[model samples]
Target: MARQIFHRSTSTFPADKVYAVMVDPDQLQARLDELGGPGAALLVYAADDGGVRYRLRHGIDPSRLPPMLQNLAPTELRIERTEALRPVGPGRYAGTVGVEIVGTPASITGTLRLTDTAEGSEFVIDGTVTVKVPLIGGKMEGILVEHVQDLLASETAFTQEWLARTYT
Candidate 1:
């Protein structure tokens, strides 16, 4: 079974600009590569008038894990079957992401909402990870939640940098 997690962040860019960069295949791929590392690969599984489909794979560095659960770290955090579904909206949009971690039957699903604001955009990302492991699973969940938050913060920073460079 999969759990649901939700997260949200607001950006200093309009909805249109944010959406443009998000749905742009090239931009998405480039950003993923930059964030996920050299081993990361993104595939456009589908793209049409409706929406876009993407598959992403990346290697996770165990060294990145917090000291508490370092012993429980998997050889790598392989995220497979990751998909982003984008739905149209009025001055805002929503997306859902599905991810599977390697060596574990558990999977995670994330929900993201982006809204246009007067000065920028608001982004919300919620993620839930279900693991088969009993005791350690809960702790792992906490770690994952923390990791997701960190990733989002880093991504927001990257977006800011990208926008500054592109606009200026």
Candidate 2:
């Protein structure tokens, strides 16, 4: 059984501005590159479709990990997914996204809700991850949760910074 996890962060930007920045292909790509290096790719939203796809490939350096895990050589971890955006209320939208971690049989599916507030925007992400590997699946779930939390924090910070630089 897959257990669900939820995480959220709020930004101080109007919905239109945030939405525009998110949907801009060049801007999104540039932000991803700045944050994730050359392996970042962004697929822009089209024709008010409100769906965007992006992938980030990060180099894993086992040397950075504890000695117990040092045997694992450096590898590329690919995070790829597409998300559908739908309006839930005025200045608010909620949607689902699918995430595939490359080279792992585990996949995560989740929903994220964005709300435009007077100060900025608030984003809530919730999801369940399914691990296809046996025996280690439970352990992997804990690892995945930690990884997701770190990723979300980094991405949220990057987005906030990018918006400040681009729109302000």
Candidate 3:
């Protein structure tokens, strides 16, 4: 069975600018570095219409995870994440996003929406994490959900700071 994870984040930067940084190779790489910390590797990068498609490999140390997860997951987790949105109108993009875990039955797929707002912009992720493993898929999904949510929070902070410094 699969579990659903919904996330909402607000960015003070406009949608276009946020999208710009997202697709820029240098900026995106840097952000991945921050997300992946010392274990970040950029396997691939491809520019898309409103966003980009990229693959990142992260060496997640076992010590950083609980014993249960440590045993369930490998020492390294490589995720191929894709973000491609078509322009719906000014400052708005709608597209599908997906995350695939290498060598694992776990994967995430969902809708990614970016829209301009009075504050600046909003990002909404409605994703489902599926683990085909029997008897433990639900528990594993909880762990993955928390991990992904943390990643999103970290990226949001990074993007906000980057926008402030880069845009200024």
Candidate 4:
């Protein structure tokens, strides 16, 4: 079964500013340094007239896994995440993100939208998590969803802080 995940975060920075920081390698590196789990790294980055895209690597700590999952999971799980964003309209951007759990049958894919808000900008992600394991797939997906949500929230908070420090 596939589990749906959705998250929306409002930033006090304008969409253009927010988008700038999101695509900036330095900003993302700093974010990964602080919030990305152990072994996190930026693997690939490319930009052109069309838009920006980047790939990152992060790890899941076995110790943080639920007791029920620890025994079944590897000692460490490496996650490769790729994200792309393109201007959709004035003050708006559309994007997509994909997450792959290396050596596992689980994956997460999502669409992202960023647009101007009265206060600043609203960033939203709508995604699905899937685990191929037959008997425990649903439960595993639930846990992965929780982790993904937490990570997204952390990333959002980091972006806000980075913008404030760099631009304010």
Instruction: List TM-scores for all candidates, in order.
Output: 0.82, 0.78, 0.89, 0.95
In the range 1-168, model 3's lDDT, one tens digit per residue, is: 899999888988899888777667787778877787546777777665545666666556667876666666556556667766667899997778788776778899999888999999998999999988889878988898998898888878888888888898
Question: Of the candidates shown, which would achieve the greatest TM-score relative to the real structure?
Answer: 4
lDDT of 1 at 40: 77
Decoy 3 TM-score against native: 0.89
RMSD for all candidates, in order, please: 2.7, 3.2, 1.9, 1.2
Which candidate would rank higher by lDDT, 1 or 4? 4
Segments of candidate 3 deviating more than 4 angstroms: 48-51
Name the candidate that leads on lDDT: 4
Q: Give a tens-digit lDDT track for model 4, residues 1-168.
A: 899999999988889999999999998888888877889899999999788999999977888889756755567878899999999988899999999988888899999999999999999999999999998989999988988889988998888888999798
RMSD of 2: 3.2
TM-score for model 2?
Answer: 0.78
Candidate 2, backbone clash total: 2
Q: Which ten residues in a row have the lowest lDDT in candidate 3?
A: 48-57
lDDT of every predicted structure (CA atoms): 0.69, 0.67, 0.79, 0.90
* Residue 133 lDDT in candidate 1: 70
Cα lDDT of model 2 by residue, 41-115, tens digit: 664344355544444344444454444223222454555666666666678777777887666676889987888
